[model samples]
Target: MNTRELETVWAPRMLSVLRIVTALIFLAHGSQKLLGFPASDGMPDPFTMGWIAGVLELFGGALLVAGLFTRPVAFVLSGQMAVAYFIAHLPQSFFPALNGGDAAILYCFVFLYLVFAGPGPWSVDATRRQRSA
Candidate 1:
């Protein structure tokens, strides 16, 4: 149809797709660190910051996938990404590419955007809003 109609109808659905895909990718990072399913160099010790990050990535990614409490979850994840970038990546070099912190920066902004966007359509949050109305 028209561009306006396409945007109106597809954008929210695309947001859901984005959320799901991002969560899956993010979860894999956690799985690598915590579960070691895909196998990594090493697993982080329990309760260490690395392990803690793994916990957040695994659980937070799941929550985002489900779009449950999307705003709050996204807020925490955004903060985590920001902290990760500064703590792990900033020291190596000024440029994100050199430091390999580009993903962190992208995740930070994307999660921050989700904090405002409210997970869009096809989300538990949307369903909850619908039922409550």
Candidate 2:
């Protein structure tokens, strides 16, 4: 296949993989908090901060997985992670190496990327656009 054709095929395939993987990870984390599974110290309590995070993760992750409303959902999820970093992770220490701040920071950036770049051409939003056009 020509380079252009290869690009078209590979890009969408990669994006689909990214969408599913990120969504699953987010869903698992959110479910753990929502269901109170494993019972970690950092896990948020229901009807509180945990509840908010759980909703964001669960719904946002679902949207991401389906490639629907990806940009807005990713933006919200990014904001949520930023808040979590500042409120929970940052106060502990400046060094992520010492604490668990690095993971939160990483999540923040990843969600931010998704917010700006969106779910790409493999998303449901893209399909909807194609249909409308």
Candidate 3:
């Protein structure tokens, strides 16, 4: 295929891939926070805000990876990332690099993007949409 044709063919698939990869990384963050793998010194205590974020990250991220309920879940995850950035990083410094809020900020924006973009062609959402149509 030519460049434009190839782009059209692959763009939605690439979005799905991006969503999956992002979700997997978010899930890993949840795992590290909740399961304490890799020996984190700062694992949040149970029932705390950090733990709660971890729970959302775990389950919501799983949903994202699966591309189920993509819009709502992505919206929620976006909010969570916003909250996480404010609570954890904003206090340290204004800049993301200095405050260590870059990941949270990035997640926030990425989730927001997913909220607008939906689940793309390869997702459960897309499959459901097709069935309904």
State how far residue 4 of model 2 sits from its true place (Å). 5.3
Cα-based TM-score, every candidate: 0.97, 0.84, 0.93
Report how far off residue 29 is in candidate 1 (Å): 0.6
Clash number by candidate, in order = 0, 0, 0
Tens-digit per-residue lDDT, 39-114, candidate 1 = 8999999999999999999999999999999999999999999999999999999999999999999999999999
Stretch of 10 with least lDDT, candidate 2: 36-45
Write out the backbone clash pairs for model 3.
Answer: none
Q: Model 2 lDDT vs. the true structure?
A: 0.81
- Backbone collision tally, model 2: 0
- Model 2 misses residue 42 by how many Å? 9.7
Instruction: Give the TM-score comparing model 1 with the true structure, all chains together.
Output: 0.97
Better TM-score candidate (2, 3):
3
Candidate 3 local distance difference test against the native: 0.93
Kindly list the per-residue Cα lDDT of model 3 for residues 65-105, writing each as its tens digit.
99999999999999999999998899999999999999999
Best by lDDT: 1
